[model samples]
Target chain A: MNPEQLNSPNDFQTIVNKIYQNEQFDFVGIALQSSEAPHSIKWDFVAGNTNERFRKIVLRSGIGIAGLVVRTGKPFWDNNLNHYEFSDEMYTPIAKTESLRSAVAIPIISPLTNLVRGVLLAGYRSNKIKISGQTALTLSQYL
Target chain B: MLETTRWINNYFNDSTDAIMIFKDDELILSNQIAKDLQNELELNPQYLVEVADSSVKQKFSPTDNCFSCIIQNKMKEISIPITLAKNMPHPLNYFMIYNVIDQNEKVFSLTLKNRGTIDRMDQLAQQRKLTQYVNRAHEKERKRISEDLHDSIAQGVYSAIMGVRRLENNHFTAEEIKELTTVIESQLNDTLTEVKEMALDIRPSVLDNFGLLAALKVLAKRLEENSGVTINVAGNANTEHLSDDIQSVLYRITQESINNALKHANADEITVLLVAHNHYITLEIMDDGDGFDVPKYQHFNGKSMGLMNMNERVKTFNGAFKMESKSGEGTTITVKFPVA
Candidate 1:
């Protein structure tokens, strides 16, 4: 499609929603480090039947699940928040807001400079899940 | 007199109390009490003599050396009340001696009581002491295990994730390989999340790093997200100022309370308030969920250690813990501790 077609938040959300339509995933969203808003990472686009709470969450770098992945340049995931333990303060806000039982976030890097500038977040509300290599590559491909 | 003497001899033979007669610093008459009491001292006989000299002479009086005799002695009795020294085996006793002239100034002496019970009780208390030591060792072990997982294992997982990213740069074809790579990525992502969650649950880095406010806020947010319950949390206390140990206790207690509410109480709304007033920090968790009879589920049986565990944490800081609930109302747990 046109590059301008993917320019807006709705467009991004529409595209992501179509991609994961048949998948078992519960929610799929994209977060980019916003230069317009404090230069920290924020969830710019979200798709799927999401709670109104997600809209109010303006994430900082290393603050929530997406923020941690984007800031640390690493992918993070957990199936059960209650069962799995985390020591960092960064993920607490994300864990609380999303009610995400099992979820993963992979850092998305620029294809040219290989510089991580965003993250792809996918999660399920049921059991704990582990993101495999193939799923990680698929996520990278989409980005 | 002979019959009495025989009974005295028999009784004295088995008794552990010191029974002796002294004549001019000579042990003229000694019973099993002497052997028992002497062995219990665990000190040089010379020390006993010195102690006796210092005490007996000071308390001694001219005519009172007999039954009414006043013997100068500073050797005060050491006994744990509610228990007998000889019978309990926990205390050691002693008997001093002083010379008394019998009719012809023969330098005959009377025996002063000194009985010790420590050796007897040592054997009994050994098991108790051992169990206590083991419990302490186990507590330290738990802490160490939690720390190692947080520091080493969690860090290792993060590093491996970075290494996986390094592999992504390679040219990959074959739909199968690409698919396999995605699977690997998901597995790593899952593992990383699990590791982080484990570390946080055991001991949150926020509680360790920024303090209780940040941690509690995180906890409150989580309760809201998962249960679809709106948890409004507000705290005026300086959570960052609380001691790390206290912070952990509060964090754990809050965790258990929230978990219990989620699992048992089908509550729709929960509110947490933490405030510092008059040198005490107070935390209250109130839920408008389905409440239950407080006395019905009060036992700390094996099934649910939730309240029991929270009680233990509160007790560690000499704090007060109270929970209130009703069949149809809801449950509220309040914990308070001094700002030590």
Candidate 2:
């Protein structure tokens, strides 16, 4: 599996849909940094998103959920968004826009460079889902 | 007699101290100053003698006649010792003139003065200044460690990874040796990545290298990605002209405010704006989330360390901090620093 082949936006969308179907998540998406504007990252592909607002949101390297994964190259998950320690102001924007109640974000690391190339997010809108480390490992296998 | 009375009236009226005349425990005369003093102390002038006598007795000894002894003393100006309530802004000091008008009259002239309050306030201000200094030192250390990690340890790890990768091609001839080298190389790369992340988390190198705006852009971008929250940063302030300390404090305040909003607010969006003008810089963070009770959160014991830390950081540089929020409304934090 060539890294470039997996990097295609369409291929990512297909993968996102598969993850959403397999995991029974309410929302699934992939955000990749633009090559021309490396600092600017956007959700290039999504499946089961509540609205189109997430697609229009342009993220910077350290700004939001996907940006955090991209910035640190680490996976993060919140079993319950409401119970999480993050400020409501930071997550409410996307949580409300997408109606996500719980979520997990995994960074896709490029093996050659050992750098995060994208983030894969899976979540629910109304129900709480405890996305454990095993779930992240399973998702990473697809990448 | 009329002339003497007029002279006493003029003296009582002209005197600045809160003066009251007591003829054998009877409130005979009190000046306007005395009335004003009573009002300020929230006391009743009608019972001034009884109140003072009881308070003095309670402070000294229940059986002692300290108040009467002071009044009976023959000294022209005798000081009456009394203890003020702990919460009172000023300690009460009183002086009495014994037999001022006539030897047989037994009239006592009492004067009240406030001098201890101002001294106590000055002491409190000094303690606050010392606390601010300690906070500044703490922040400085955090910045130093962040810089050290980014400049020294992370860079060293990168070089070591490169060196180890080069060894895999030339030195490891056996297949098993080559495989072991590959495992070691991968572990070292993981350590390098961890070190880099730790450096950024401690303090972003971009903050020191560029300035506040660039640093904020990086923070906002990453926060948005990790939380799926929308954060908009708009500012044209050239932080390069500002001192490193001011820039660091502002960056930290911005970071903490964003973190607070994300973890607690359940908000939809956050907007940060920065402006510099006329030797002053203003930074504002606004969030459209479920706002909190500002006073309650501020006073809530140990629950708002983040807010307190932000306030202390701003105070270190003599900046003004303001936060406004209400339940179901939203929250906004603004800080202003004088660059000049």
Candidate 3:
């Protein structure tokens, strides 16, 4: 994939949708931090959002799962979100809003600055779908 | 004898304390004060035995033998602790004195006085002191914010304005003007950052938008970054159903607890847990730090407003607050609020 293509919102949504379709995940989305407001992160594109709540949320850095990824600049994944003790409070709102059970979040780091600029999250509502850290790293290559 | 009888009646009626006369285990006469006390205490006049059984039965036994002892002039006075009602402000110290009227009827006069009124008054006074401490905390916070604005943003903007006015001068070269503009722009950016920090300190917008859990996560992250203490937040509580007022209260409480742990407790790790149940919500913050003697700071002495503020905030929502700690051991603060 060309680096320039990722700059366009339309192309970004198309790529996210394609990843959701190719991986057969229940949900896939992207949360990008606004350049003007560095503290704000919004779910710019969501492939399987049940409601508009995800779009309305302006996640602060170090807040939700996406915020955690952005703050640490690291990939985060949970095989079963419910079983993850530390992420219980972190994932409830996002999981309930999107009907997700297991999820993975990978920070999209800028090549030049090596700082996290956005997050790519993929998950499933079905309990059988287990997301592993290896799968998150594999998907992160697409970014 | 009629004049003396009238005088005795007036004395009994004018007594401040409740006075009841009993003869042979039956209430024979009660003064106006006694009637008022019965109504105020919500005691049943018909079940005098049950009343005595509930109040004086445990301590003095108000039984037939005791009454006989008093009538026989063996016991001069008997005092027993009596609670008029459950959850009353205080208990009363009931006193019974042996007396004879006209040498025809043997009688016992009962009087009730509140034993814990002084304690209750002391509690009210302490509460007033706590309220004043809370006010001082608010006042200090306001002063800090004002000073931050005046010292940083106000000065930055004043310099920027002076720079713009200087740019109007024709004596300055193009390069000099460009450099001055860059300096002014940087100053403006710094001022904006300072204002944002002040706004966040007052009330983080994320708390209102994303609820308590999100706000707490942000707080934990900030505290960890600043203090180098690792904070792990666990448990899932759906705070979307709660009112904004409740969310704000819980967020502020957690914020204060974390701050106290960072500043006072020399701990390397802190854990915060939030859980929601059928009827209530629970929040626990524990730190592996050197703990202080809890009893020393439990009173309203105006030195430790952090704990007091957290306690008052929890109480405002009718919540239960508890703190457990020991010297050299860790401290844990727990708060529980009923879901409304």
TM-scores, all models, native as reference: 0.43, 0.52, 0.48
Q: Docking quality tier of candidate 2?
A: incorrect
Isolated chain A TM-score, each model: 0.73, 0.83, 0.86
The segments of candidate 1 whose C-alpha lies over 4 angstroms from its true place after superposition are A1-8, A20-24, A34-44, A55-104, A111-113, A125-132, B1-231, B234-269, B274-283, B288-306, B309-320, B325-330, B335-340
Quick one: best lDDT, which candidate?
Answer: 3
DockQ of each: 0.03, 0.11, 0.02
lDDT score for candidate 3 against the true structure: 0.70
User: lDDT by residue for model 2 over A13-44, one digit each (tens)?
Assistant: 78888887887788888877555422345678
Residue pairs in candidate 3 whose N, alpha carbon or C atoms collide under 3 angstroms: none
Candidate 2, B83-168: lDDT as tens digits? 44437776565442223444387666666654465467777886676577668767876886676567545654665566566665
Candidate 2 chain B weakest ten by summed lDDT? B94-103
lDDT, residue B123, candidate 2: 70
Candidate 3's displacement at residue B92, Å, is 5.7
* Candidate 1 chain B: worst-modelled 10 consecutive residues by lDDT: B75-84
Order the candidate numbers by DockQ, best to worst: 2, 1, 3
Candidate 3 per-residue lDDT over residues A1-143, each given as its tens digit: 86545777887798798897788788888887665523445678888776665655555444446656765678887666654322233543355456578888888765433456678888888978667778887787778
Q: What do the candidate models score in CA lDDT, each in turn?
A: 0.62, 0.70, 0.70
Roughly what TM-score does model 1 have, to 2 decimal places? 0.43
